[model samples]
Target: MPDSIAPDALRRLVLPDRVHRSLYTDPAIFDLEMTRIFGRCWLFLAHESQIRAPGDFVRARLGREDVIVVRARDGRIRALVNRCTHRGAQVCQAERGNTAGFACPYHAWTFGLDGALNSVPHRQSLPPDFDLKDPRLALAAVPRVESYRGFVFGSLAPGGESLVEHLGPIAAVIDNVVDRAPDGEIEQAGGVARQEYRGNWKLHHENANDTLHPGFVHESSVSAARGDPRDYAAPAYDGHQTHTQMLSNGFGVREWQSLSLTGFPAGHSYMGGFYRGGVLSPDRDDPVWREYRARLVARHGEEKTARVLGEDRFNNLLYPNVSINAQYQQIRVVTPLAVDRTRVTAFCFRLKGAPEALFHRAVRFLTNLSSPASMILSDDIEIFERVQGGLANSEPEWLDQSRGLGADRTEAGGRTVSAGLSELPHRAQYAAWLRYMTAAA
Candidate 1:
């Protein structure tokens, strides 16, 4: 356990447009975050589609606690601690599977899918006072579990804000993801791609909404794609480079401009310009794209369908832990393993009832962009490690996120809107980070 630091001292670490490097490297600060942020905030769990059948379960983690998200025989989903109450041993080992119940290998103690104490060996030999209904004897459960459009979340805190309230304006972005499904459903299509980095987890979420770095950091990949061997050494490539060219090669340079970045309360934000011009204009001519669009058009009018498809926010930062890209049909979950190590898992989602080719396209994007060995992502991971190492030097105590500081304007629902290249997303995140880290538990 880490000794608690005064809240005022913590506040000084986070400034309006700058933050102390210790926030990313301090073990004590990381411990406090595990309690204050991860413990209270609603963190994304397995999707509802993952546990469709009774007795189906998937292993998950809430901060430091290992949990099992299972569908009970009674058709209810529950998140239970994976530890056995009797001897403190893990009860479930499978990553995900269907089972009648979990039997602890340590003592043969059994728990039902709903986490109820179902059986114990040597019943007659046990103490007469042993009570099966005791709360401590049953498999412990997460305090709260909820889902929005099949994306499930669990909270360790007993009470705070509901999942919808926590999501706020970001809920619309999530809706864009699910609503894109022709039948209004999305499922885990392919297995997840996992990667681990020797850097803080916050860097991953911060980078998700950082649009200013792509043109510079990924210039090699872009140059390779564009067949231009010229080095990206000029200042023009810094923050003024072509936005569409910085993204995947599928998008044409003339098709779009710098994206719109929106930052809302609770550290939520999204960045993309493709929402205006549309993401799949080329795919518009494909049979798979046409078939899927027709289904959506039948359900919603042609105008509404076009608007939904065009609302292409490339990456959505779901606060502290998850980054979702609906356009790519990928959800990336960040797990902090230590003060300096973080693990990321990217899962591919398939729009239910959409054409098979559409699913294949999603997988191709996942492989080419989000995979651990991806050309684009490898550059990001390398930079994160470099940044982590650079923070260790004894020179600058604060990191600057001053780009577009005063340029952001307030929008409806208290959201802050600005050009996609702005650092408003990082500012929004640190604002929430300061609040959560300093607030009373």
Candidate 2:
């Protein structure tokens, strides 16, 4: 641990809510998070759909290193460093494409879909000791890469728990994400939106579950054509208003009491959101909607299906990488480039075998309504940026996250959860973060 750990790092963290500002503002700390947390953790790599066919590929970063995920001719997926063995040139320049093989643009060295060395301009001219069978000549696969449902993740460390084990309780949510479809799958549709934020990447992760900021922060959307959820939830029980912030907006009101905050090892947390969140459209006579609800009710019963569709979830951080709102068909990934700047990519998934319009509705909810381009998203981004700027102030010695004190709950596992709005997820994140930072490399 760094000397700056203020002897109070432990005391600085109060469970179920509140965290030290250092986890957000300190550069040294962010560096360690990138390694111990992101490096060791199963970081989101790409959707399996992104590489569905032979030679299809997408370049994703694990921490700061670039990795290329490709599908072999046999339809198996592989993730390997993008770096070329010859002079370390990136083997593939395009972000996404299908290819028979990848050739380094710098030296024209080629490799097959399996990342095997294919050809060199002058292979025989090279030294006899240049063994093509050597692992160094072929692309180096990442230590660990796996998919949960269709969501993919890459880890630099090999010894951590398997992807499913790390997912813990949220596995159900992941299943819920796809199982909503009659075919039990979800697909990337309507493309994706990428945005850069001038804040620590963790801010996005923390903010993913941030329920308190929506009503106050996203005033534009809340104030516009569809009045904000806060205003809507306040009095009239209209069923048409979009929850907009949905689950994350739960923090605005202090209804965390009686809620559960389930934190798992390796830093993941979730809690409950009331069913009366924002608004729900009356179940219409659409065939797909009818089938979906009927199937859900059949399997989980009306109460559970009602629970699933009724309230928005507080937020579920996928840990060190992705945060997903399964109910909303949204997943956001936070990629850190520096201590101060982070890029977030948000994607909306379509329920497999569902009506075409259902996916379009989700797209509208996300782009025009939820994401940064969305009026509410714009405001939320503003809030995150303001937090970044405010943290730079020399005026305050430290920042405070103390909220819902003494409310966090520890479960059967070494984890905790509190009210819907508690900052415990942030605290849990930092706790895991600290463990990673101080852990032996």
Candidate 3:
């Protein structure tokens, strides 16, 4: 597999119901994906609340490119490549902080919040033709940055689909998350948890909507939770929500089949929520939930609040990089470090005007599912590495994705709906992957 894989060759790698294993194991294919897929897609960057004040900034990634997402003096959000124009050294080092300007350590070349070249230490040492205002001297800016409901996305390609167009029907999921906030705002809070695994990046998204895997891959946790004598539903019970979450995955095949999985255009997909009891349940009727419900009803009226809270979705994936669980105020971003290594960063948001306890629950949800120490995620990471190791073999070059191959049906909104355990989501993702990877330059 060459780096410049021809369009026809790329087409052969992905069939309607399966894909080549090399797509996951080949270094050259990963290199091509960094540009063709990650570079061109509208990737989730940072939420508006993260950079609320002028000079506020956070480090983010677009494929292999390190970027600084900042609020400039003009109060507009901007995404600039972290590299300084002089000698290509990173200009900003801190993970996140408010700074008047970024001064490169390699050479004191400073850039403003808007990525404009501000000053250089040895100005006179440069040639006389060196113009202070030269656009080439500034940090490179991501060509397009757009936001919908405070969720910002950036595209490295100079021109492509607009952010909304790229999001397709997936935009409603974001709207649902924001609408759940009583004040119609959500902020990144409780920091982030990052984990690295020795697996291809696509495995995360593939496993996200695979309902069948939980009963099998997570059998140990599920069994342990089931064997515990503690009554999770007892009013006086005090325990982490993670126990309830683990118990939720113990659902039998019939219950799992009852859940719906939907795949939209552009590789976006989501599954029906499965948590049925404990604080994790959407309709949990405890005092804290009642107070949060009252605040929401006061803000959006009873009907709208019910609708907002009633939208039961889990693991909504925005193709190539992000997995969003809007109902839980959780998001996980996938960053491909190499062909066999990837990093996932998870963050939780606080719903403005909601009860403080609700936000705490969200943080706990983030930690229980995504933290490096999480029992659930640790199991998945081990499996991912095992799959990567298994793929090293030369035999059986194709991975089948034909579970429920002909069962998917298109809905009125142009989205595909499949049985809960179907592999339609994987096929849908590969469809989008082929389109982007093989598109004419």
Clashes of each: 1, 5, 0
Each candidate structure's TM-score, on Cα atoms with residue i matched to residue i, is 0.92, 0.86, 0.96
Tens-place lDDT digits, model 2, residues 314-345: 45777777777676587777789888888878
lDDT measured at residue 125 in model 2 versus the true structure, 0 to 100: 88
Indicate the TM-score of model 1: 0.92
lDDT of each: 0.82, 0.71, 0.86
User: In model 1, which residue pairs have backbone atoms overlapping below 3 Å?
Assistant: 275-312
Q: Pick the lDDT winner.
A: 3
lDDT at 203 for candidate 3?
91
Candidates sorted on lDDT, descending = 3, 1, 2
Candidate 1, residues 1-441: lDDT per residue as tens digits?
653888999989998789999988999999988989888899998998889999989998899889999999888789999999998999999999999999999989999887888889999999999988888899999989999888899999998999999998777777887888888889998878889999999999888777667667788877675654345554443122232333453333233236678888799888767545543332356566789899888777899887888776767888878888776578888998899999988888888878877777677667666787687778899999999999978669999999889998987777898876678888889888988888877
Worst 10 residues of 3 by lDDT: 231-240
Instruction: Give the 10-residue window scoring lowest on summed lDDT in candidate 2.
Output: 236-245
